[model samples]
Target: MTKEFFTATPVKQVFDRIVEFVPVGTEKVPTAETCGRILATDVVAQTHLPGFARSTMDGYAVRAAATFGASESSPAYLEITDTVQMGMAAQAPVGNGQAAGIATGGMLPEGADAVVMLEHAAKLDETALEVYKSVAPGANVVAADEDVAAGQKMLAAGSRIRPQEMGLMAALGMETIRVFKKPVIGIISTGDELVEIGQTPVPGQIRDVNTYSLAGTVGQAGGIARTYGIVADRFDALRSTCTRALSETDMLLISGGSSVGTRDLTLEVIESLPDSQILFHGIPIRPGKPTILAKIGQKALWGLPGQIASAMVVFDRIVARFVGHISGNALSYRQHDRITAELTRNLSSVQGRTDYVRARIVEDQGRFYAEPIPGPSGLIRTLVEADGLIEIDMNTEGLEKGETVFVTLLR
Candidate 1:
C-alpha cells in the first residue's frame, strides 16, 4: 500500500507530542554510580559545608585589629600560644597581643577573624612572631556555610549528576540517591536486503549498520538499547516483532519502510497493533522527513529512515529528545553547547523545510569558520568528517558566504 503526506508536522510540535507520555519510574542507586543520571528528588544539604571557619592559607590566625600599623619599618610582635593541627580543634584562643599558628584548611582559633600569609610574618623566636602587613577581617578565611548552607537545595530534581555534584553529595553524606531509571529501547531493523554485520552480503544486499549505530546513539542519550535483530519487511513478521518489542521495552525503534513504496509495511504493522495511534508520519525536516512516530499504550515507537546518516540525524534530534524527557531530563534541562562561526561557502535550502548541514570547523587567525561537508545523506562519511551541524532556519531560504552561523556541537 502507498501513503502520501499532504502536510508534514513541525519539528517542535512533534517534540511536544512525544513528551506527553509519562516518565518511567525511579530507583535508588549508589552515589558513585549516579554520574550522568538524572536525580529523581531534590538533594538538600543536611549540614553546612566546612561546618567551621577555616584558614585558607598557611599563616598566623589573628585578630585584625592587633595588626594595625604593623609594617616592615616597625613590625608588631605577638606571642604564639599554640599551633592548629590539621583535622583537630584549636588548642588555644588568639588573645590580644597573642597569635596562633594555623595551616591551610585548619579551623580558626577563637577570637581570630583573619589570616596573615606566612610571607608577611617572620618567626622572631619559637613563641614570638612579627607581623609586616595588616589584613582585614574575614580575609583569607572561609566562614562556615560559605560553600553551602544547611537546608540549601544543592541539586534540583531533574539535574544530571556530574563529577562536581558527586563531590557535593559525598560532602553531604549521601551514600545513595534516587535517580530516574534508564529507559530500555528495543531496536529492530526491517528490510529484505539487510544482512548481519558478520555475514558478507551477496548481490542486491547490504550489511546492517542502523542497529549498531542507533544502539550507540541510545547509549549516548542515557538509554539502554536492546537489539531485536533484523526482521524481513513482510507484514506478519514485522507486526509480530513490533508487538513483542513494545511489550518488552519502554520504547521501540523500527528502522526502514518509512517511505512510501511497494515493500513499506512499517505503517501497516503499526496500525494493526491494538490501541496504536500514529502521532506523526512525516516531519518538515530535510533528510528526516520520512520519519514516523506512534504510540501504543504508554510506549513510543519510531520508524526511522533506512539511510544511515538520515536515521542518525532523526535519532539524534527527535528520538534523543523523547528519551531525555522520559528519563527526567528534558531537552531544556541543560544549556546546549554551540559556537558561532563564519560560513566558508553559501548554503542553499528550500523555503519550507529546515536544513541541518554538517560542517567541518576550521580556525584561522583566532576566528572560526565552518566549511560545509557536501555528500548525500546516505553516505555516513559525511557525518564522520564533520565536527558539528549548522542549521538553516525554516524562514530563511539560504545563507550567504561569510555569514555568521551557530554550529551545534555533536557531543
Candidate 2:
C-alpha cells in the first residue's frame, strides 16, 4: 500500500505529543545508587542542617559588644575561659568580659554571638586575649538552620540526583530513596547493506554504527538500552522484531529505512501493528528531516534515519529531550550546558528548516570561537571531531563570520 507523505511537523509539536505518552512508575534505590536517578517524591529535611551555631573560622567566640572600640592601635583585652574542640560541644558558656578559643566548625558556646578571627587577636598571656578588630553579632557564625531548616523541602519530586544531591541526602541521614525506574529502550537497526562492527563491509555494504551510537546516547540520557540486533529491510522481518521489542521495552528506536524507497519498510511494519498511531513522519529540521515519532499503546516508537550522524542528531534534539522529561530530570532545556561563541566563518541555511551544524570550539585569548565541521551527515567522524552543535533558527537565512552563537554541548 502506497502512503501519501505529509508536510514535516514542527519539532515543538512532536515533543508535546511525546509528553502526553510518558509512562508513570517508580522504584526504591539506595542513596549511593541514586546518582542520575529521578526522585519520585519530595525529600524533606528531618532536622536542621548544622543543628547548632558553628564557627566558620579558627577564632575566639565572644559577645559582639565586647569588641566595640577595639582596633590595632588600642586592643581590648579579655580573659580566656575555655577552648571549644572540633566535633565536640562547647564546654562552658562565654561570660561577659571573657572569650573562648574555638576552632573552625566548632560549636559556639552560649552567650557568644560572634567570632573574631585569630589573626585579628593576640594572646596577652595563657589566659588573656587581646581583640584588635570589632565584629557585629552573627558574624563568622552559621546559624543552626542556615543551610537547611527542619521540615524544609530539600529536593522536589522529579529532581535528578547528582553528586551534590547524594551528599545532601547523606547529610539528612537518608540511606534509601524513592526514584523513578530507568526506562528501557529497545534499539533496532535495519538495512539491507549493513554488517556487524566485527565484520568488514564489502564495497556497497557498511558497518552497523547506528545501534551502538544510539545505545550510548540512550544511556547518557539515563535510559537502559536493549539492542535488538540488526534486521533485514523486509516487511515481515521488521514487523516481527518491532512487535517483540515494543512488548519488551518502554520505548523502541528503529534506526534506518525511514525514507521513501523500495527498501523502506519501517513505516509499513509500524502501521501494521495493532492499535498503532503515527504522531509524526518527518520533522522540519536539517540532517534529520526523515525522523518519525509514533505511539503503540502507551509506549513510544521512533524511526530515525539510517545515517549515523542524522540518527545521533535526531536522538539529541528529540529522543533525548523526551527521555529527560520522562525520567523527571528537573533541568530545563535552557539549563543544559551551552556557551556563546563567535563563528569562525559564514554558515548558510534555508529559511524554513532549522539546522544543527557541528562545530569544534576553540579558546584563544580568553575568547571562544566555533569552527564548523564540514562533512556529510553520513560521516560519523565529523560528529566525533566536533565538541558541540551550533543551531540556526528556522527564520534566519545564515550566520556571518564572527557572529556570536550559542553552542549546545555534546556529552
Candidate 3:
C-alpha cells in the first residue's frame, strides 16, 4: 500500500502536535533536591516573606517629615533616642524630631516610615543626629511582603525549579515540593559506516557522534538518557532495536534513521509497531527538513537526520521542546531561551524554508550583536563557533545588517 507522505508542514503546526505525548508521573521531592525539576503544582506563599518591615541600611529610622530639607549644606537635627539591633524586635516609637538608630535588616520602629543611610548621616552628640540627606516615606526599607505576599502564587504548575525557587520555597516553610518525574529518553544511532567510539574507525567507517551528543542534550533537558548501541542499516536490526528502546524509554531518538538512504527502512520498521503512526515526515526548518516524528501510544519517536550538524539542529531546536514539555516545564524554553540581538551582517534566505543560522554573539559596550557563522551544516566547527541560532522566518527573504533578531541560545 502506498502511504501518503507527510510533506513539509509549518513549524507552528508541528508544535501543535505536542498534546499527543503525555507528561510523566509526578512525585514529591525535597525542596533541597528539587532543582531542575518541573513543578506539578502551584507553589503558594503561606506567610509573608521576611514577615516584617525591615531597614535596608544601617542608619536612623525616622518619620520622613523629620528629615525634610536635610542636605550636606543645610542639615536637620533630631534626637537619637534608641537603637534597634539585628535579630531583635524594634520598640520605642520615634516621636516628633526624634530618630532611632537601626542596623540593616533590623525591624522598623513604630511610626518610622523611612531610614537615612549611615553614609548620609552622623551623630553630632550622644543624643543629637545630623542628617545630611533627606529620605521619603518607604525609602531604604523593604515592606513585610516585598519578596512574596501571603496566599500569593509564587510559582505556577509547569514552572521549572531553579536554585532561586528552592530558596524562596524554603523561606515559606515548604520542605517538600510536588514535581513531575524526570523523563527517560532512549537514543539509537543507525548506519553501517558507524563504529564504536573506543575503536578507531577504518577507512570507510567513522566514530558514532549522535549517541553521545544526543544523550548529553537529553541530560541537559532534565531527562535521564539511556543509549542503545548502534544499529546497522537493515530493517530487522532497526525494528528490533526500536521495539526495545520504545518499551524501555519514555521517548526515543534514532539518529540517522530518517536520512535519504535509510528513510524507507526506518519508516517500515516504525509502521510495524503496534499502534504506530507517523505524525510528520518533514518540516520547513533548515538543516532538519528530513526529520521524522512518529508515535506509538504516548511515546514520541524522532527520526533525526544523519548529518552531524543537521541532527544537532533538529534535536536542539525541535526535539528539545517535546522533552521539556513532557517534564512539565514547557515554558522554560519558550519564555527564556531566545534573546534579541542585532545582526552583524546581512543574510539572504530562501523564501519558503525557515533558515536557522548559527552565529557568535558579539557584545560591544552594553549592546549585543549576532555575527553569523557561515558554513555547511555538516561542519563541526560551525556548530562549535556558534553561541546561538538566528531564525529567519519563511516569508522573509533576507535580514539586513544591524537588524534586531531573536536568537535561540544554545544549551
Could you list the CA RMSD of all candidates, in the order they appear? 2.1, 2.4, 3.6
Q: After superposition, how far is residue 124 of candidate 3 from its true place, in Å?
A: 4.8
Off by over 4 Å in 3: 1-6, 65-79, 91-93, 119-125, 128-136, 332-349, 361-375, 396-407
Worst 10 residues of 1 by lDDT: 1-10
- The lDDT values for all models are 0.89, 0.89, 0.88
lDDT per residue (tens digit) for residues 1-411 in model 1: 012323888887897796568788999999999999989999999999889999999999999989999999989888899899999999889998888999999999999999999999999889989999988899899999999999999889987899999999999999999999999999999999999999999999999999999999999988999999999979999999888988889999999999878889998999999999999988888778899999998889999999988898888767888888888885433435789999999999877777889889999999999999999888888988988888898788899999999998775
Best candidate, TM-score-wise?
1
Model 1 off-target regions past 4 Å? 1-6, 331-335
Every model's TM-score: 0.97, 0.95, 0.87
Model 2 worst lDDT window (10 residues): 1-10
lDDT of 3 by residue, 1-411 (tens): 002223587788888998888999999989999998999999888899899999999999999999999999999999999999789877698887999999999999988999999999999998999999899999999999998899999899998888999999899999998999999999999989999999999999988988988888899888999999899988888999999999999999988868555245778888899999999888887888888999898899998887888988888888888999898886945733778899989999877788889999989899999999998876778888999899898888899998999888888
Model 2 segments more than 4 A misplaced: 1-6
lDDT of 2 by residue, 370-398 (tens): 99999999999999998989999988989
Q: What's the lDDT for residue 399 in model 1?
A: 99
Name every residue pair that clashes in candidate 2: none
Going through the candidates in order, what is the number of backbone clashes in each? Answer: 0, 0, 0
